[model samples]
Target: MGSLVVFFQLAGAVALLLFGLSLVRDGMTEAFGVRLKMALGLGTRTGPRAFLSGLLATLGLQSSTATALMTASFVERDLIRGRMAQIALLGANVGTALTAWFVSAGIEAIAPVLLFSGYVLGRRKGPVWLGTGRALIGVGLMLISLALLGHATEPLRNAPEIAAFLPMLDAAWPVALLFAAAIAALCSSSLAAVLLILSLPLPPGLTVVLVLGANLGGAVSPVLATSGLGVAARRVALGNLLIRGLGCLAALPVAGLAGAALTGLALPGAGLAVEAHLAFNIALTLLIWPFTGPIARLLTRLLPDEEREQEHGPRWLDDAVLKSPLLALTGASREVLAIGDAVERMLGQTRHAFDSNDPSPLAEVLALEDRVDRRQQQVKTYLSRLGRDASEEENRRAITILDYVINLEHIGDIIDKGLAPEVRKKIGLGLRFSAEGYQELDAMFLMTQENLRMAQTVFMTRDRDMARRLMELKVDIRNMERQSAQRHLIRLRDGQPESRETSSLHLDILRDLKRINAHIASVAHPILDEEGLLIESRLRMG
Candidate 1:
């Protein structure tokens, strides 16, 4: 019963720690996600800047894993180079250790003050205030959890079961390494694992081994998360893992000596765990940073890009199904959904290209636009062939699908001709949007992407509620675009340097995105019109 109670207490403390970390991550993202993304995207112009970006992003997010995943996504899109990505993650590794060190700085006494401040600030409005408040609250929670963790483990120091089990771990150091690695991997957080390890009363060498294991295991979560991002993403993540794995392999042989040297330092016991974490990453960064270029090249050869099949027309539209109007309409609906998918891809690639000031991704965006054009035409032609014998409702369904495909094609055109060229000009002329201007545009891009996805759902399901929600979001997008343009003009009036050459590009993008949003909102019309919900115009008849 005592053992179970102790286990529950430990688990609760760990859970609180993880929750605190998430709050910090979420708050930072909500407050400054755009600027952070831009820093990570643009900061890769040099290796050192890339490293700093990753380090700072990790510190703010309280999760190196999130930084890694974000970095992998950029690599996948070719917005950042593989070599720089590896270096950045090395920085992220150091950041994680720094976080562990900072939290262990004997300031748990201020937890209540931070908690109160965070709560008061959290109640305030605006992204910055709310985000800062949430982050402070998270920090306070983490500190409190650390105190609780100490209390929980104070008993383990006297527990006979722990005394026996810990010695068993000391006799078999490799087992201890794997045990800590497993804990970090399971928690998906090395900081949590290190803090937990800090609270325990382990032998000096064993404590070092556990920290090493935490570093090694910390690389696992990002690698796993990158599976869905793409091959380049996977490569970036896998590269980090291999680097850390190699470092661990070399360090494992000397854990005792390094542990003894650090433990020999006149520092306190809690400091030992954090110092081990910090020292390992610092040493690993110095040793590995120089070799990141060669290592990235090696990974490319080891995991060469998979060969893709030639692009072909409309995968979902089947002629055999044309005899059945129901099947034919369903296939067309699915085909339009696929076109929306392509459009989403185009927007993503375009946005990345703009952010990086690189025109390479625009080539894929063009290719995808062509694919979108071909698919939409096929959808239209297929519907034209649907027989007159079809019922009125069947004909109406065909028309609805036609309307959606046509609207989707308009979105494609806007992405292809409007946003793509503007982005190219912005990049080609070396024009930079003011930080405020760019943040506004980026927010619209994200909102439009989400609204596009929601529009797809509305078209397929024709759910009145989702349709209404999408329509409402369309209004929000328009308002956002208008507000952004107004802010850009204000910046211009004030003679903001960044607003000078990029004025036309910024306004053009806002207009195009708003137009695209208007088209996407049209998909909700039929569903809404059926429920007597859509207004023909906002104007009042005189």
Candidate 2:
């Protein structure tokens, strides 16, 4: 019963620590405008530079997982080379080691002072002190959480069952190392694993070895999370394991020296353990830092799989330089332009299907429509992240363009799936249109195609004049739809022999035509309604 209480107490401490770390990470990301993903875009041109970027990013986010995931994302997108990934992996290890040291050192002792100061400052009625105060509070809670965790573990030192385990830790350092690594991996958090090791009242040498093991296990979480990603991403995760695993191997002789030095250190034993942690990481970084280039090149040779070929399909829009918002915006615009081209081609194919009576062109239109839909999704995802760094004007522009492109893609789907298939069905059944009906249908198709083109133009240029013209064309197309539907009904009432199929085809074509007009009108909506139509629609009637 006593052991159970201790167990729950330890669990509560761990939960609090995890919660504090999460809050700190969130505050830091918000404070930095969440540019960790952008910083990771710097290709591994040089190992040192890549390492530097990784260090800064991990330190900023206070989570190696965040940094590694971002790096893996870059690798998957081909934004970073395999070699850069190797260097960044090493840097991430060093960064995570830094956090462990911060927790172990005397920094945690001053938690209360900082916590109270931050609380007072955080309540100030202005923006200036709020962010700094929030950051300080994050740091304070982070420190206090660790301190509480350490205090919670004090009873473990006196418990006979726990003390019996302490002898085993000293007797079987290697076994302890592997055990620690497994714990780290299963926990999916190196910080938690390190804190657990710290909570044990073991000698400093054993703790140092366990810390080393924790570092090795830390890479496993990201690896498992991103397994089956691109070869480059896999290489990055593998590279993390290689660097930490190799460091552990090289430290075997030093581990002997570490144990001796740790035994000689003063009372609390924290200072010595912290020193070992720092020295190991610093030495590892220095030694591996120079080999980043060779390791990178070697990884390239080992993982030489080609990307799936994209022919007239939406391409992945990842670039190392897109770490910058301006650069990312440029890439997004280029992708949007590609999507626009696909939309235009789909519309053109729809027109050709009408003119040549060829279903093949309509099939091609369906394929292009698929490409447009995919590209729209890709653009929106990239833009949503970019929105963090965007100015108000840029944000508004991005949302507007995305809105227009999404609608335009849907318009293409309507033509390809709705109108084209109806036409193909009629043609396959040997149904022929009357000369007058054919002329009217062709004219309506041409006008709708023109509207699609205009929508793309207004989206790309944000030209208010073009948008206005599109609204006028949208009204004209609606009139055309009404006229076509009425004429088809008249033909059916007149008992035309083919009126059944004709009416079906006419309604499908009219639906497609009207959908295109709606999409065109949507392009102008960023500047339209003249009376806040969206807001007014939600207003309560008096």
Candidate 3:
């Protein structure tokens, strides 16, 4: 019963630690996600800057895995070179190690203070304050959990069964390593696993092996998370995994020597696991930093790009189903939804290209636009064959489907021809918006993407409330665009160099995005008109 109680206590402490980590990640992301993303996007111009970018991002996010996935996304958009991404992950590893060191550095005395301050701040309005407060609360909880972990493990220190098991694990380093690796993988956090290991009483050599395992397992989560992404993204994640795996392999043979060296050091108050984690990552970074280029090339060759299968015609539109008007209309609706998906993809790529200042991502926009055109044509042709015998309601439904698909097609064209070209021009001319202007445009881009998603839902469900909300969002978009344009002019008048240089480009993008939102919002109009919610005309009493 005592052992069981101890087990629950340990489990509870670990859960608190994980929850604290999550709070920190979510709070920081909410508070400074855009600035962090922009900094990461812009900071990778050189090797050292890239490393610092990753280190700082991980420190803020409290997860190297998050940094790795973000970096992979950037790589997918051609924002950062693959070689630089690898180095960034190297720095992220070190950052996480340092985080562990800090957590275990006798700071639990301030837990109550942090938690109280966090509560006080969290009650305030505004996202920035709320997020920062939540982050502070997370830090407090983490520190408290560390203190609990120490108490929870005190019983195990004298337990004969655990003492017997330690020697067995110490005897088989590979088994011990896998055990720790599995713990890390299951937790999805090496920091958590390492902290847990730190609480256990174990030999120094065994601690080193276990910490190495935690590092290896930590890299696996990102690789798995990004496995479905493009080849470029997959390569970046896979390269990071390979680097960690190699580092672990090389260090495994000398675990004893490394462990002895760490123990021999005069550092006080530092746990063996934390010290080992720091030493291993520092050594790995130094050893692998120079080979990042070769590793990137190796990854590219290993994960060669697969040929994309050409989608010639509508996959969902079947001629045999045309005899049934209801069935045929359903088929057409599904096909139109697919086109909506394609448009969303194109929009995402365009936004990514804009943010990264890379034109490579735009290369897919034209192809997706062509696909949208061909698929819409297929839907129209298929719907035209529904026969003159169709009921009036069925015919009305067919018209609705056609209208929505046509709107989707327009959005695709605007993205491909208007937004794509505008972004390319911005990149080609080395244009940069003022910081305020950039944030305004970025906020609009995000809202536009969100509105597109809502429009899709409205198209399928035709819910009156959602339709109303979609119409409301249209006004919001217009207002945002108008305000952003005015702000751009204000900055230009103030003689801001970035604003002056990119004035035309910024306004053009704002106009195009607003136009796109208008087109997408059209999906809600027919629904609104049918429900007697839509105004017939904006022109009122003379």
For all candidates, the clash counts are 0, 1, 0
The sequence of per-residue lDDT tens digits that candidate 1 reaches over residues 1-542 is 88888888999999999999999998887676655776777677688999898899899889999999888977875567899999899889889988988887789999999999999999997666888899999999999999989987888998898888988988887888888989999999999999999999988889999888998888999888987867889999999999999998888889889889998674553477898888899899899988999999999998898885566877778999888898898888888888998898898888888777889989988999899998899999999998667889999999999988898889999999999999999988888888788777877876677678778888888888778767877877778887888888899899998997888888899999999999999998999898899888999989
In terms of TM-score, how similar is model 1 to the real structure?
Answer: 0.77
How much lDDT does each candidate structure score?
0.87, 0.70, 0.88
Q: By the TM-score metric, which is better: model 1 or model 3? A: 1
Model 2: how far residue 269 lies from native, Å? 10
The numbered model that scores best in lDDT is 3
Tens-digit lDDT string for candidate 3 (1-542):
99889999999999999999999998887676645666676677689999999999999999999999989987875567899999889989999999998889988999999999989989998667888999999999999999999999999999999988999999999998888888998889999999999999988899999999999999889989998999999998889889999999999999999889998884566788999999999999999999999999999899987786777888878888788888888889989998998898898889888888989988898889989998899899899899777899999999999999999999998898899999999999888888898878877776777678778899889888778767877987898899998888888888999998888889999999999999999998888888888777888979
- The pairs that clash in candidate 1 are none
User: In model 1, what lDDT does residue 33 have?
Assistant: 63
Ranked by TM-score from best down, the candidates are 1, 3, 2
Report the C-alpha lDDT of model 2 over 194-298, residue by residue, as the tens digit.
877766777766878887888778888888877867677877887777787888877854676776775675434355545555667778888887786677677
Question: What TM-score quantifies how close candidate 2 is to the native fold?
Answer: 0.57
Q: Evaluate model 3: give its lDDT.
A: 0.88
